[model samples]
Target: MLDLALEIAAELIRRPSVTPEDGGCQDYIEALLQPYGFRRIRIDRGGVTNSIFLRQGERAGCLAFAGHTDVVPTGPLIDWPHDPFAAVVENGMLHGRGAQDMKGGIACWLAASIRLLRDGVPIPTMQLLITSDEEGESIDGTIHIVKHLQSHGMLPDAALVGEPSSHRIVGDTVRRGRRGVMQVRIRFDGKQGHSAYPQDADNAIHRAIPALHRIIDLDWGNPAAGFPATTCQITNLNGGTGASNVIPGHCDAFLDIRYNPANSADEIESMLRNACNAEHVQLEFDRVADAFATPDGPFLDSVTRAIRDTMGIEPRLDTGGGTSDGRFLAKAGIPVAEIGLTNATIHQIGECVALEELAALSAIYASLIRNFEVNG
Candidate 1:
């Protein structure tokens, strides 16, 4: 199992599929699964590659594994210990850009599925939802696939997102939920004038300061259970012209808010508008991702059991993380759990994962598939 996973991970890393570009990664995946009785369904859009590989089972329900083939850009060739796309393995670590975030995870899932079939294990209907737009705009990624499944009444009972969710070990942690992201751009308008003529022009900076203070102090209520409190930060602020002698006519501020389910986008937007009460101020809010939590139930219990059975460790059910494609599945009323290799070096220059960790994760995924029951 480990050897097969390593081979697939190496092949995937060799492709420089950055952001929205698949770089032939999906084609490679399709080729691998087609021989295993999996049928490929293409749902590409906006130049983004999305495919669903479905393998019918002798069992009753369908199970889906969601993942991405694309990776973030490599920062600099000189900075990396090995080529980011080289998939080098040394000292038990697989080194590359997507090793942990997460070509490695996808490899583990495929390896487990292949092993199960070869061993004559009774498995449920399986679906591999692969997308290349995860690291970019995400406008035409898994969401579209979920829509297609929904229209055809083919939604799985649950889904396991192959993100690097573990922290210290392969099965030490799993994310049952994620906080939502909201971004705002606020622009304050004022007449420009010479600094010496204070009475002739209103200072945009002066107008922005008190409102920003109000925004900073606005009350966001207590957080939801099993999640962190809502957080709002003024990420960027620009007010003055380069010339100190000029009172700027415009001031711009950007806010990044990560909110728990306790606060809705509507409530947050209303509060910001009321706080920046100046008529000349303009506020634009983009609810980038919606907060979602899968309540504790059979699906979660099965995942925890699989981790404990495979690695002898009771995993932490966490909700802390940046937004992910899991939000889309959760929004569609499907229970989602994120599990995979350790995320110690995800999105870093020296990003890599231990070969043993990949093997352990593959075992865990195999356990999940073997023991999964839709009505459990």
Candidate 2:
């Protein structure tokens, strides 16, 4: 099983499928699963590749493993110890761009499923929800797949997202939820004039400082249980012209907010707009991703039990992360759990994963599949 996972992971890493590009990764996956009685359903849209590989089981329920074939861009080839797309294995590590972030997790899940089938183990109905639009603008990614499944009444009983959620070791942590993201762009208007002529020119920077201070001081309210407090940060600010003597006509500031379920996007927007009450200020808000959580229940218990039984350690149920496609599934009423390899080197120059970690994760996934049962 470990050797099969390593081979599959290496093949996926060598594809160079940057965000919004599958680079034939899905084609390879289809070929591998076709012989195992898995049927492929394509949901390609807006130049993004999405696929659903399904295999009917002799058991009672359907379980899905959601993942992405896309990887973030490798910063620079010269800075990496090995070629980012080479998928080199040395010193017990597999080095490549998607080695830890996602492709490795997908490979492990595939290996586990195949191993179970080969061993003649009866498993639940299985689906592989794979997309290529995760690391980019996720407009037409898993949401589309989820919508299609809903229309056809084919939603899975539960889903496990392959997002590399472990912080230190495989099976040590699993993210049951993620904080939502909201971004705001504020532009303050003022007349451009010489800095020396304060009376003739209204200083945009002067107007921005007090307003921004008010925004910074606004209260976002208490966080929900088992989640972090909402955080708002001024990520970018620009006001002055190239010439020191000129007062800028416009000042732009960008706010990135990560809010929990306690606060809605509507409330956050209202707070920002009310704080920046000046007549000349214009605000643009983008609700990038909505916050989601899966309550402690049978699905989570089964996953944690599998981890504990496989690795002899209890997995921590965490709710910290940027965002993921799991939010889409969670919103659609599917119990979601994110369990994968350690994410220490994800999106880094020398991104890599230990071969041992891959084997352990594969074992956990196989256990989960073998013993999975849907609870009402």
On TM-score, the candidate that comes out on top is 1
Tell me, what's the RMSD of every candidate? 3.2, 3.5
**Ten residues in a row with the worst lDDT in model 2?**
218-227
Best by lDDT: 2
lDDT digits (tens) for residues 4-68 of candidate 1:
99999999999999989888988998898888899999999999999999999878778899999
Error at 261, model 2, angstroms? 1.4
Once model 1 is optimally superposed onto the true structure by TM-score, how far is the C-alpha of residue 29 displaced, in angstroms?
Answer: 2.5
Q: How accurate is candidate 1 locally (lDDT)?
A: 0.92
TM-score of each: 0.86, 0.85
lDDT to native, each model: 0.92, 0.93
Please give, for residues 217-299, the per-residue lDDT of candidate 2 as tens digits.
Answer: 98988887668999999999998888999998899999999999888889998889899987999999998889998887999
Worst 10 contiguous positions by lDDT, candidate 1: 367-376
